[model samples]
Each structure stands twice: as structure tokens, then as C-alpha cells.
Target: MRPREASALDALPALPRDDDGPVFAEPWQASAFAMTLALSERGVFSWAEWVDTFSGELKRAAEAGTPDDGSRYYHHWLAALERLIAEKGLADPAILVDARDAWDRAAKATPHGKPIGLSPDDLARIRDAG
Candidate 1:
């Protein structure tokens, strides 16, 4: 993943899962979906355009013989997000740098050695803070 895209993922909170369920649950996907929504709301790209680009990327990847694996799907999503940011020149490298630094600081500061994972509520707070 690109540095900024990785930073964005790192900024998100961990997804809670049910005890008797698959590892990936609604919460995890929702976290990713929320990131997409937040980025769109910030004018990085329109929702329709973002969906189109990501869908196209997935199709291209499948055509290129990459299996439809979970990792590959997430990678494609990250790549698409990176491309969108680059195409619009919406998120500055400096801004990403700051985010990266803040993420590092937050990770270090979190209690119980938990990485800085934001809940949906936390995301809302961050959005409002900005």
C-alpha cells in the first residue's frame, strides 16, 4: 500500500467480531467502507467515481490472473484509493506525513499496547475535530 493509504488504514479502529464467527465481520468491512465514505466526503472523489475506479481495478486484477483472495481485494482497494487521491491532488504528501506522524504517536500512547484503532464513534470525533 502507498504510505498515505497505509496511514489511513492504520488510523482506523480494530473491528470487533463475534466469538463464533468468521474473522472478518461486518465491523471490519464497515471500517473500510467508512474510510471510503469519509474520503469521499472530504472531496477526494465522488462516490460514483470511486466505486467505478475500484470496480475497474478489481476487474483488471482478475483479468491479470490474480486470484480473488482477501489480501488481493484489500490491496486493490488501497491502490484504488491511492490513485484517487493522486488523481485529484486532494491529499498533500505533507498532510499524509502529518497523519503518519500522528498515527505513530497515537499508537505509542494507546494503553494495553493496543494499536491506535478508532471506533466508529472515534471516527466521528476525528471528523468533527477536523
Candidate 2:
């Protein structure tokens, strides 16, 4: 990883990191972490901007009476990322919502341990809705 990406990892202090790497409770959590670094490195947003957004997210959850436990930290991270992506106009928010719903449907339909795959029809539905 580049120096900037390495610094991005510092933004995630809640996650347990060792010489190997940061540990995640789930695969999707790691995927979200990777996406944040990739987008930051691509100039989608500055690391400082991410810190502000993520900080606000954490504060919001606390104000809403959510526990400070680390279990939901990644959910807030994802919310911050989605907010930033929309705020930056990098992607259409409606398209993102549509894609998320499609994925929800696909995941719901898939059996446990099976890789969730979106059918062509699902893409067509998402595109049409978007």
C-alpha cells in the first residue's frame, strides 16, 4: 500500500491491527475497509474529509443512544462512506440505493455459504429503477 493508504489505516483505530493486518469480524467489513482506502487513494476524498465524516457518524450513533461498543462501528463507517460518495457526486445516490436493494434481495435469496450472485434480471431491474 502507498503511504497515504497506510495512513488511512490509522483512521481505523478501533479495528485490531497487527503485523499481518487489521482484523475484521466479517468479510464485508474488510471489504468496506479496502473500499475506503481505494477511494481515498484515487482522490475521491481526502483522508481528513474521511476522518471528519467518520467522526460525525460515530457521534450521531452515540446521540441516538446506540452503545459505544465496537460491534457497530463498521456499519457507521459504511454510512459515512455512502454519505461522502453522494456528497462528492462520485455516484448517483439513487443508483446506490437501487444497487443496495438488489444486493439485499440477492443475499436473501441465496443459501447459506453460497456466494451471492446477482442475476442478469436483477441488474436489469436495478438499471431500470435507477
Overall lDDT per candidate, in order of appearance = 0.70, 0.86
Model 1 lDDT tens row, 58-94: 9989898886655456678877776777777866656
Writing each residue's lDDT as its tens digit, candidate 2 over 44-126 gives 89999999999999999999998766768899999999889889987787787778888998999999999998889978876
Model 1: worst 10 consecutive residues (lDDT sum): 16-25
lDDT of 1 at 68: 68
Supply the global lDDT for candidate 1: 0.70
Off by over 4 Å in 2: 1-22, 108-113, 124-130
Stretches of candidate 1 exceeding 4 Å from the true structure = 1-28, 38-44, 63-65, 113-130
Listing every candidate in turn, what is its Cα RMSD in Å to the true structure after a full C-alpha superposition?
Answer: 15.1, 11.7
